[model samples]
Target: MKPRVSILAALLLVSVCAKAQDVNVEVLQRDLDHPWSLAFLPDNKSILITLRDGELKRWTPGEGLSAPIIGVPKVWAKGQGGLLDVVLAPDFAQSRRVWLSFSEAGKDGKAGTAVGYGRLSEDTKRLENFTVVFRQSPKLSTGNHFGGRMVFDGKGYLYIALGENNQRPTAQDLDKHQGKLIRLTDQGAVPGDNPFVNQPGAKPEIWAYGIRNPQGMAMNPWSGALWLNEHGPRGGDEINIPERGKNYGWPIATWGVNYSGLAIPEAKGGKVAGTEQPIFYWQHSPAISGMAFYNADTFPQWKNKLFIGALKDKNVIAMTVNGDRVNEDGRLMTSHKQRIRDVRVGPDGYLYVLTDESDGQLLKVSPKR
Candidate 1:
């Protein structure tokens, strides 16, 4: 069944009292099973989408969605572990290279996040020369909290965010890959200048540690700073600027409490001496997932603003960013009532969002004519 498109006749308000331009939410595709991420091809019209069920598909406005592209690697599609993120190489137009992050299996039924790249066939029907370049260390049996978001910074370095795999203490363990942000060359080689390269017993790829479950990562186009958002225990969802060699306090200092409604034992009321503090946080978690920064001309009013997908809140959060500080502007698509999985700013300057559901949908938010 085709999902209904919602085109609001009334202008969408950007803030409590300030009114914004009218916009419409149009369903571009429907019946997607757990769509995780999307990347716009150089053509700006074609898109590659990854499904959590371990399939990659292509979609174009008039051509519709293609059959699952072949040659995808095997994924441990259990719990939060599965095929998660897909992005094109910075030189994709010349390289035809595509990168992917997914949950891979290990001995004793353990699993961890893995990354690889492959060339997209000219026909867009298969991936060629796919190779696994990196894998998270010490795979565990737990099935939750696999942070699989991948981002390429202005310097052509790739950053991979990882979850703690339900083990909180590991966030502070440099020896473990869980709950850490890893930086690597495009080919997955550790840079000699990495913060932990000379630190014994630490993973050389470790860029920063003490993250809980980072689901949103993006490089700000204006300032070239890497920004991230992660889930908190009961509340305290946060927006952080991840810097090299910095430690982001996770379980040790969070604005959230345990699921049992109890205070975190190690947290000194959500503040720690040596850990970096979040630029912005929510006392009530929104379960943020994807991140995008608007630097386009299509929506002049939204220029330089940040957009984040909210899973639990089921809305797209719009935040105004000035330098390193952020403030909530408003929410969008609240009436849709679907868990937002991913969001991106298309080459045409429109906003594309994916809804997380059994019958998921790809929606485009454009100015209503």
Candidate 2:
């Protein structure tokens, strides 16, 4: 014999489930001009934001958006090239230093990715003693593919991601800084123990080679490992945990094809000898951007999960990670239809996001009461 369930009983169960999954999203600030990245201050009461048009602003709960901070270097502001990522020093409370990445214009109107840092003035209106630490070598003509993400390993070193400058072949060239993950000391010195230090014709600053346009990178709090996401030509957006001196196959062994719909001869099989494979890849590109791990205790349901901002998909993706592999859990802000430029786990244990648009916004997501 079978037992029948009543409609009222099922309805009650649905209501309870809906309430348990409720989340709230609030717009903290709007009308930003193509905001690119976000970083929370040590005090947890203020945040720094980078605008692609070469302006930096600070935001606070009580004072709102602060005036543009001076002392930033001039940015190229071309297609996909402009002021990019900003991060506070690990010891910012005492040192008051902050790092910034941008598209630096060079001679002959060429541009490339560059990283710099300066101490924040006591008045919070300017950067003092600004200095350019590293610059991508052999600046190219194209303005696209200036990968400018920045992340610190919590070990006195910082990593900078760079693009191939729309020149796919450059990725495999060790002599050039294009399409490489570069490591440097906190003071911008290339460590003598770098992977290619002893190799001839290779840049001593390169930690890994053959990357495409890596837009996101972070250090896992649980494992203390570095993870990154890169964009492919047509498809093949990839997630990788790159190791020292490894070669992440880009043009030569990608799951993507040319923009003109031509097959990549070397990537026909999607694998090549001596090249590292991505842990996971999307057959269709979502144009992945910044990412963060949900280690804050405020959201019990999202604890230990990884969140990545999607530009083309216009959403924030939540993923479940088990060891080295990851699976997509869900998407956030789909209904809003805004391109997510960055995702950050704030110091207050809530999630903050920056939307990319002429009238971009900063948003916060938290558990609903």
Candidate 3:
């Protein structure tokens, strides 16, 4: 059965584009400090974006950008730790509520993924009354990876992805918080409907376990299933659809190995039953950042496609999705060296992108002549 989708006809904004015929993209704004994630508000006229340097800024088309909105909680802001994904509640306009995922330091100074929810000031720019909805239990400092991506299932339950924090063994240790995809309520409470909610010694919040550094995540446009992309050391990037109580083989099993030129035996072996396999895998990894499903009508050519931005590849990947599986189709870029940090589908039918640079830029894509 085909999934019904709304026609994407709304144009976000109209300005004298660089050029409609040649599709030249202009730097509407520049000099951003390590922007990580961006989410459009319900209005589709404004946006809330986060920076890896621990700042959140609101941006719009005509009036340009707003000064950094305060009220973000203190973040560790080290290596891979800092402010991350931002999303509005399903009833955002009425509730004025939103969610955020970030990395923060614990007593031992070790940073881990933390989830929080707060109400947005009427302007939907800054946050208020921020509270930790979820925090990694028995936190340990594994500074490298904290998959702080958040997605809400159809039932209004929240799903979060946490990284392995560079500790491979933790991905398999059921007792630890590392390498787990969690299920929670809109307010970050454990949903009683969780697969293992009644299991002994099992964390009720855990939906699936075993992820390395899952930075890229999206909801399947057709199946409405959740998709994830995790980092690989040298190669072997993976994309998986997590199932309840399943263990995605990480550390103990993978197609890639360590970066120090040393091959960890486990990274190459241990693929057995009961472990979930990725729908797609990338060798010679691209260091993926963020992902989205392209359902925009502006680019009927790219309808039903998946867009993934990469840091190492420094390009925006366009993919074709048939059901839950995918095929890499095209790689688009502005031919610049700036790392691609994030990819998002605008409410209007365009692709808005963020680059990873000391002085980064936020760009939008339209038709090319």
- Quantify all predictions' global Cα lDDT against the true fold: 0.87, 0.85, 0.78
Model 2, CA-based lDDT = 0.85
Q: What is candidate 3's TM-score against the reference?
A: 0.90
Clashing pairs in model 2? Answer: none
Q: Write the per-residue lDDT of candidate 3 for residues 181-295, one digit (tens) a residue.
A: 9989887789887877898877789889978888888788678889888887777677788888888888876766778767765664535566776776665677888999987
In model 1, which regions exceed 4 Å deviation? Answer: 1-22, 367-369
1-369: candidate 1 lDDT, tens digit per residue: 110111121112222412233568999999999999999988878989988989999999898899989889999999888899999998888889999999999988989999999999999999998999999998973788899999999686999999999888888999999999999997779999899999999999999998999999999998889999999889877788888988889889888898899987767756687888887777777799998999999988888889899999888888888988776767788778899999999988999999888799999996555
lDDT string for model 2 (85-119, tens) is 99998888888998999998889888999999999
Instruction: Identify the candidate with maximal TM-score.
Output: 1
List the lowest-lDDT window of 10 residues for candidate 1.
1-10
lDDT score, candidate 3: 0.78
Error of 3 at 275 (Å): 1.1
For all predictions, the C-alpha RMSD in Å is: 6.7, 7.6, 7.3
